[model samples]
Target: MNQDIIKSQWKQLKGEVKQKWARLTDDDLTLIEGKRDVLEGKIQERYGLARDKAEAEVRDFEQRLRKH
Candidate 1:
């Protein structure tokens, strides 16, 4: 997803982000905030996903959040 869309609806996405990344601590979410790159990196590191797949998952989640 594009950064514009993510920026527009990040507040709503945050909850979904937390749910999907349940292993991430509150501090992790706090640190991620609106930075998709950071979020992608953390998800890759914590979940052992390849970089491209992790990014796509984050993009998918962000897009799903925007649809609501």
Candidate 2:
């Protein structure tokens, strides 16, 4: 999905995000607030992933969301 769609639909997507990234806290989600960069950073920090890996994971997640 596009950034605009994700931003507008952030509330709805929050639960799914939490489910997918169990290590993330509610605080992290709130901070993310549908910003792709923030989400990528949080994933990188929480999962101990490299920047490229974190970005790829987020891209994959976005693609998955689009598929649904």
For every candidate in turn, the CA RMSD to the true structure comes to 1.9, 0.6
Candidate 2 local distance difference test against the native: 0.94
In model 1, the Cα lDDT at residue 10 comes to: 71
**How far does residue 38 in candidate 2 sit from its true spot (Å)?**
0.2
lDDT of model 1 at residue 11?
A: 76
Give the candidate number with the greatest lDDT.
2
Instruction: State the number of backbone clashes in model 1.
Output: 0
lDDT of each: 0.82, 0.94
Where in model 2 is the C-alpha error above 4 Å?
none
Q: What would you estimate as the lDDT of candidate 1?
A: 0.82
